[model samples]
Target: MQTQLNKHDMSSIKATIPHYTDVFNLTNTSRPSETDFRADIKETMVKYVTFLRKNDAPFFLSMFPIHYVNNNSLDFDFAFMDNRSSHKVNDGNATYTNAFEFLYDSCHWALAKANATSVKIVIGAIGWPTDSYPGANVANAERFYKTFLPFIASGKGTPMRPNQTINVFLNNLSDENRLFLDLGSFQRHWGIYKFNGEPKYRIDFSGKGRDLYPSTAKGVIFMPNRWCVFNGNLDDPGKVEYMKSLACSESDCSSLDLGGSCENLTYVEKVSYAFNRYFQTKGQASQTSDDKCHMGGLGKVVPNDPSNGKCEFPVEILSAENVIEGATFGASGSSRDRVHGRMSLSAGLLALTVLWMIL
Candidate 1:
């Protein structure tokens, strides 16, 4: 079972006789390679290296080393790195035309500094976003996936590492809203599916070169189909503007931003979009005493779909009562933490039931 350890737990595990690290240790996630190696990082590396040398156990150390111009080996058994060529599409003449070539060069560069005779490589994350940025769109995302998926499925590897089978892990399966702290808005939209379990576009995951729609998540229940809209007249837009700003501050406004899906909306529509997002994000059912949807009497709840062409005003899922299907294994946090979250939820439900019985 995978459990994300804290700093203290990590130290304890390292000090323990039998090191309880995974078979493949993916050290870095989105760290820039240009930064100087910190003392703590060097210390951790020394400990891991000593452990590896002392034991004949089969363990692999993978890291994301991007700016390794010098051929200094990291001495890891395996290397995991990301190749985001789509982000460099608008670099004018320096645009990356071929993602495969870029990935090949990156892998080769990392291999040169590996210091090991044979270091396996895993293409950690590589995908394109369809929203939340100027250049981000469905066409570009589709183009990237169509080309990259087939290339990896073909098992052609790279120019330098030809005939070798490279394991490729797609960036994400669905869009996430809460990951904005660690990732950009464009990063949230990197999934093949939208936030509501709906397929964004057709993708052939089987790698047969045929485009097919992926299966949507099952048993997902959502809150009521009501939306908070701008009740005040458009002439007096000051209050509406304030409400929009407040709503955006409290909830996700990425989908209604400058290059977002709702960017082309009118002033009224944009304000309503922001209001509805805030309403939904605050748990459409109202989880707390202060979780109110009223936007200073300027917002009204209506049972209408505010979704425009290519833009969807989402009604978030009621996930608290449901057993989240695929929330088991993730890179977010530990299983213990996840279990505790579920337990707290279960306890809340039990208390509510007991209160109802008493009444």
Candidate 2:
């Protein structure tokens, strides 16, 4: 897979091996002619994926999308590369809107080119991160992953080729990763193994894995500097301790002032690194909840016990039936109560059984 830069700069690392997959590190500044870069991409396409079409040998290619940009993502398209995308990629001028635009456009262009030559290509590594970003929310993440990510894996092709699933492995969840020395591409990933390094998204393709091989080919496309650590070895206990203390607390959180320090970064940071909505929005006051009785925006939420002035979410109003039929994410907190009730009943039944045995 290629780690091509954004629309402005298209200088991709030329592939050395004809059979092996390589990373492409995308994201460049403005250019006079991005068309030339597009040409470069096409030329490479003609040489590699198309060139080896005659060979019967089975091979796989994979990639990672460090940048996944879309405000709504409903009409997201990959034609933004040269602004040939079907959607309104441009607002007014030549719009190089976000990094993910390149990815989406490049995907379409590459596949179409391959088709022109009757070349067969296997799609790989498409997914959405399931955490908050500067602008993205948990709802969007869940929607994107649960619906869109699976759509990629399901392959939106013909019914006969239903088994021919495309590959879209997620980051942070698939492999055993390590903390790098932060020597290259973009940022440093200190806790690469955020647990077992399991893939953020999992796919069950009914035993057919493009032959169904269970592994991702690459990540962040071409960004070597994306998530590597430096100097203080992560394996070092003292270093980890100092890093955590300096990074987590407010007293020594000055590291944030610097362009690249993990100071003040949270676990949530690792979950959704480049998302737009990860940071809290400006001017929006946090929900300063005092026992729920507050002005719901402009109107006052009158409490049932008016003297206490403490309002609660109308649990009785939001019944299990209401949640199941009306809620965006199926039955809300009521499921917890349902489980508790079931457990209580089961416990009572067990107690009666013991009493019967004693009698």
Candidate 3:
């Protein structure tokens, strides 16, 4: 008699638990970025997956993201938006800029090495914070839930990983039951639930799971997390002291250039700032345009309208000011329809007003 998983047993050849792995340390890890631990685990899993698929055995794997760690330590000298950049700090942390690419490569390599088709991988943790951090307010938390959870959910099957769902897990369901968000060497507030035990109202990952138990329990939906709230103020004196060794050099401050422009995200505001010696076009203070968004590149501009779709100004002719509205994860730019964008001040005001009225 042979075990159903007998054929897939690389156990004889493979390493097992703790395995010096970040097993119990989903929020913490030996590696600072996704780079340190690459395909070793995936390659090992791939072998098992291939064996299982060939032998016709069911296999399930849980994948927790380096959600809290990036290639660089959180930089305070930089503005908030500089979170994306490609440079690396002397410390092990990867810069947020190059971090995404690193994540993509590692995941892709693992999937490929796993040579796995039948084996399923689920992204067991992920999310964004609602408040700015510290206050840990419910409204901010809820607003983030509104956007973050769904974004992770929406990113379910990447263009490459289609058919491979990275099921995110529900909040507070941490296998280790870690109530705290323990990012590697960084301060974190990454749980979706309040310290007091109330759930943020935005995401339904867990509640929906009561119905979804069978599917996810069996590996259908992937990557479900309530939220991750990391709010160490760039100005936080504590972080400066705590994360000093992880800090960048004066040459590598925030993602800003010597003149403060996003090499990739450079927009009219930065451009305008450079040329005019001030941050404005004519008399209007402009909203900084984010790199990922393109409202309508000049193609939509009419003959006299001037925006020739090249993003170059039409030479100040017959102009209404361009209101750079920042980036959105989706086209509508409406918080109601998308995930991962900042909330409007009006909405904040409305939420406050409602709270005031309710109180």
Please name the candidate that would achieve the greatest TM-score relative to the true structure.
1
lDDT of 1 by residue, 1-359 (tens): 01233333543232222221112122331212111223345455444444433332222322212111111233211111124323332222233334344334443333333332244445555566677765567775665566566767788765556666666666566555556534346655776665444456776776655776666433334555667787756666787788789998877777776568888988888888888888877756443465456787777778877778867777655555434453332223221111111112423343344334323
lDDT of 2 by residue, 91-160 (tens): 2233443333334334333444454324433433433332222222223333334334434545553221
Rank by TM-score (best first): 1, 2, 3
Compare candidates 1 and 2 on TM-score and give the better one: 1
Candidate order by lDDT, decreasing, is 1, 3, 2
CA error at residue 144 for candidate 1, angstroms: 2.0
Question: lDDT score of model 2?
Answer: 0.28
Worst 10 residues of 2 by lDDT: 275-284
RMSD of each: 12.4, 19.8, 20.8
lDDT per residue for candidate 3 within 1-359, as digits (tens), equals 12433567643333212121232222333222323223335445555557655555443333222232322243321211123333433324333232322343344444344565444444433344322232233343354344334445554443335434355543331111112334321112344432112233444453221211111111011111111111223445454333321221211112123211122333422222122211111221223553111111211111232122212221111111111333211222222211111112322333344334323
List residue ranges in candidate 3 displaced over 4 A.
1-46, 55-105, 127-144, 151-156, 162-166, 173-190, 195-197, 204-359
RMSD of 1: 12.4
Q: How many clashing pairs in candidate 1?
A: 1
Task: Report the C-alpha displacement of residue 43, candidate 3, in angstroms.
Answer: 6.7
